[model samples]
Target: MLKRRPLAVLLGLALLSGCATLGEGGASRLDLIRQRRSLRCGVSGKIPGFSYLQTDGSYSGLDVDLCKAFAAAFVPETGAVDYRPLTAPERFTALRTGEIDLLSRNTTMNLSRDAAGGNGLSFAPVVFHDGQGLMVTTDSGINRLEDLQGQSICVGSGTTTEQNLNDAFEARGIAYTPIKYQDLNQVVAGYLQGRCQAMTSDRSQLAAARSGFADPRRHRILEEVLSKEPLAPASVGGDQRLADAMRWVVYALITAEELGITQATVQRRYNEAKRRPELTRLRRFFGIDAGLGEKLGLNDDFVVKVIRATGHYGEIYNRNLGPQSQVPIPRGLNRLGRDGGVMVAPPFQ
Candidate 1:
């Protein structure tokens, strides 16, 4: 006969298993967000085209719109939000400590940042597809990454930007000095102040920073991309409920774009869905039939709320980083898969 464990030992094991289950399915963060009546969102307040504080004491940018979208989805019509401007180093800590419910900064999703044994953050779908690039003064005669082999590069500290810089330069056997700052604003300042010959960041960010300069034409982003940076929103890991809700929220943005559901056309599409019961996908997407949003622990009409608050992903992008915006980045890989870009979303069904 197989030997049985001691009574106390078996009880202890059972208790431990129960505790683990509780930790996994504990008091839902989604419920807390609903009860709190607002979302505490973290963002890099200094990045111009991503998230910036305006003269009118308002926040505007793609990331800012994302926060509003989340608030709209979670809090319904009012879209109440508390914007917490966080530095590169402070973003993760704030999320983990419950200081913020969502981090919509231009943060890259990497293995270390998403892994359970690492930063333990659950990331939403990528909202921005960017690449690391080196920005140098147009008159510097630097046309490529190798040109800065012996020069100092200004970079934001404690970010994937810095790591990608080192990796790219090292792989190419290009040695350089790095002047690090606590955040992107400081890094841009250091570059403008002549503390470094070049500044490295997401190419789109470089364009954003350049546009703010007195002479924007003086800076040029190198064509050689250093690395792929798929930026997304993040929340503290282990909250599957919150993660599920956030993931689907982002997917809603993409799905809206894929379905040609513009802000002005959302209600039209909803009406069509209502009148035509055969439009199965549109019916479920707009919450006319429910299920999708409820599966993520959100109101069935959250997608409709999000779109009304922030528009679809393309609209948000064009409004922030398109030609008319201060920071204009060609929607290279950010376009929909059908539009020859890589972005796509799962079916609402």
Candidate 2:
């Protein structure tokens, strides 16, 4: 016959176990963010049209807008983001360790990254469909990947960009020296300082780098694309609530664009949604109906807040990468599917 432990002792042990779970992976990420009052977002603060720190003392770009969209969905500040500037190697570790609530850095969605055996991140929808390409000085006469044979090329380390560069060169029976850097800024410096004959990155990035040069026309990006880069926002794999909320935040951006809602138009749309019971889709989208935001553990006005903060997906893109913007890459594949591009989202219902 064994004596039973005190009820207080048993309760203490259970609470300690719960606390331990919350210490690492047991707590809900959504709950954590709400409690913390700000979204810890990882971003590459070097890419101009994607995510960059501006001279005016604020972060701005397509990725920054995505971060704002996420923050606006939950926090009251509309753009309550504690931005964590991270390099390629540092980004995934930050997410997996719960250091960040989300990663809005222009990261690619790949099998190794999304798999549990790998980085174990859940990717949001593809926001930008890009391709890797090479950039060379106009004087180099390196018009094609074949022209890069036997030349030293610069690339960002710890990224698929490097692997794709190697695979492309090797498959072509070409040999080149790789000068790698941990940061995109360093890669650009190495290229500009003549450390390499050519540099490679996502073609949009190549355009961005060129736009800032002393003479933009002096550098030219090659027509040869190395690999497809479908860039998206990412989160650590375990939390379903966090994952689901992020998925819809991204979809809300796209859906708003498809439905012709912008920052200026969202308020009126919200009023329309509130007054009308007949517009089922619009009402559900703006959270006028019951069940949309509740399912995600967020307020019903979440999408409204998101749109008011960052407008729609198209607005974010155009603000950073449009014709008047710094890097004007044509929206070949970044447009809505109905607009002849491949971006589409699930219905609000």
Best by TM-score: 1
lDDT at position 260, candidate 2: 96
Worst 10 residues of 2 by lDDT: 18-27
Candidate 1 lDDT: 0.87
In model 1, how large is the Cα lDDT of residue 203? 87
Q: Residue 344 CA error for candidate 1 (Å)?
A: 1.2
lDDT against true structure, model 2: 0.87
lDDT of 2 at 344: 97
lDDT of 1 by residue, 157-215 (tens): 66588889999999999999998889989998899999999998888778887888998
lDDT of 1 at 115: 97
Candidate 2 runs further than 4 Å off: 1-25, 134-200, 215-226
lDDT digits (tens) for residues 194-245 of candidate 2: 9999988888888887888888768877767788889999998878888899
